[model samples]
Target: MNEEVGSLHERLARLEQLLTAAQRKPAEPAWRRPTSRESRWAVSAAVLGAVALQLLLPERLAFHPEWLLPALELLLLVLLFPGPRARKRRTTSLLRGGGLTLAGTVSVANGWSAVLLIRGLVRGSEGSDARTLLTAAAAIWLTNVIVFALWYWEWDRGGPVARAEGIADYPDFLFPQMQSRELTQADWEPAFADYLYVSFTNATAFSPTDTMPLSRWAKLLMGVQALISLLILALVVARSVNIFGG
Candidate 1:
């Protein structure tokens, strides 16, 4: 009886050791690795382009004083860029928060401009000059592309940093290169410019082209972008054409 009790205690101790070892093991990553991180230069240039585009919009279509939104966007960019080398996690969260804030600000301003443009057209209050109307519509269309591109860049695979870290097991957008290792390098991953191209293509085609949206949010965003692009083309561009013809 004494020998049996000792053996039982030994087995229990071994089981506990196994359990502890299992708990200490790190989780295995489900996806391929060695993803190259994207540079911030492209993103910064895109944001600056958005700011310039906002400035091109008509005064009535822009925020009061016309420069207010641009100034705010510039300020956010100034604060958000130059991410710290240390304190990586905290700085990443801060940068993401600031990036989303900047993107949201631009989205709101552009949305406001879109709404006002549509309202003015419906109410017949917008200027009748074809050139000015066309220019403004073009600016809005270009801004729309940049805004959606920013969203895609920031959201795909839990943002750029997350992608670089290979934290996400899957991607939100499926580029052709991701489908096959033969198409590109083993370390190939979507970058900000890729998202921008996707946005531009989606806006032009009013649908996904080569790249496909794999997530619900991606599909919804593309749908909204299509709707807005359609509205700008159908209403604003059409009105400008009619004015020119008249």
Candidate 2:
């Protein structure tokens, strides 16, 4: 009886050891990293904020229209330019990064134009007529449209190329050949092709898994922008109708 009991105890211990070893095995890597949905949300929020600020704030509080426009323009330029040094510093896929940079530029330009128009309206200038206000709104809307289009285009190109090549799809590493290596376009083709592939792929797929912090921040930005735009639009329309008699 004693021998049998000892054998049972030993067998149980071995089974537990095997289970622990199995549990320690590393998980398989993901086939593809997730997209940055948080970033998209953040961008959307920023756009909404620009619109809201134009619409809601009293002309007095939101003064300095010129400053916002130029600042945004500068930001766009920095983001879009893919100098060799930048490529080395950040391993983002070339095409997607460039596309994003272009989108940022377009957004800033459009936003600045809107700000100028709003400034005119607040200043009570003749240029602040209904026609101008409408034009400004249209321009802002166009900026969003352009950005969306660019995003989609990049996404379309990036997806298939990554899969076909069996390479990691992260933008930072995928499109090195598209960038300027030493202040020349000589190496642009290969880099550009790789970039296009990554951008297209990422656009279609959700950004690789990101922490909740980024996602929340993006949502917050979107909400702020949306609120600002809605308020500004409302005020502008109301003021315009009052001045012009419908």
Candidate 3:
């Protein structure tokens, strides 16, 4: 009886050890390092371009100050760019947080502006020209694409830099290339371009195409993005028909 009890405790201890080992993530290899930086230029350009497009939208669809949202977005861009080498320095976290916050704010502003544009168009355009309305719609659609791309770029394992660092063991998105070793280098990490593709595909299809979301937040974000895109597409179509018919 004594021997059996001792053996059972030993087995339990061994099981716990295995479980702990499984829970712990392996350290990133020395040769395979995460990129300290991401596509700052591309993302910055996208933000600036989106701001420019927003400027083209009618005054009624814009924020009260007209320049408020764009000005704030541009300020974030200035903070993000022309800085000391943040990637190699201690300011990495601050820079990353700033970028993420900027993207989220711009997304909310653009999304809200888009809702206003759609509402105006659906409600007899409020005496606005069809051409101007459609142009604003196009700009809003492009802004939607850019904003969500920024969101995906900023997120997914806690942004590109963190992902490259391998700080987060879990993947929020599972891409096909991630599965095939031959498709990429052994130390390959997804970049802003990959996330951009994920966003574009998701927006177009209104669902996951090549990449699958893994986490609850990931799934929810994607679903919300799809819903917004659908509403935009539907409203645009309905308004277009009304414009031609009347």
lDDT of 1 by residue, 1-246 (tens): 999999999999999999999889675433446465667888889999989988988888997878788999999988877863433788889988888998899898888898888888778787498778888888888999999999999999888888878888777898888777686877787888999999999999999999999999999999999999998888886677677788
Error (Å) of candidate 3 at residue 141 is 1.0
Candidate 1 vs. true structure, TM-score: 0.84
Q: Write the per-residue lDDT of candidate 2 for residues 1-246, one digit (tens) a residue.
A: 999999999999999999999989674223243322112333334444444444443343333564564456445544544332332324445635654665565455555555665665566652346775665555454444444434433343253234223344333232332233455343132223333333333323323112111234333533444454554566677667867884
**Candidate 1, after superposition: displacement of residue 21 in Å?**
25
Candidate numbers, best lDDT first, in rank order:
1, 3, 2
Query: How high is each candidate's TM-score?
Result: 0.84, 0.40, 0.81
Error of 3 at 198 (Å): 1.4
In candidate 2, stretches whose alpha carbon ends up further than 4 angstroms from where it belongs are: 1-18, 25-97, 126-132, 145-224, 244-246
Which candidate has the highest TM-score of all? 1
Model 2 lDDT-worst window of ten: 205-214
User: Considering only N, C-alpha and C atoms within 3 Å, which residue pairs clash in candidate 1?
Assistant: none
Q: lDDT of each model, Cα atoms only?
A: 0.86, 0.45, 0.79
TM-score preference between candidates 1 and 2, better one = 1
User: Candidate 3: deviation at residue 124, Å?
Assistant: 3.0
**Candidate 3 lDDT by residue in tens digits, 1-246:** 999999999999999999999999986543246655555777777888889988987888787788888998999899878543555645777777888888887887787787787677567654246677668778888888888888887788887667767777678888776778687777777776777788878888999998999999889988988888888878877777777788
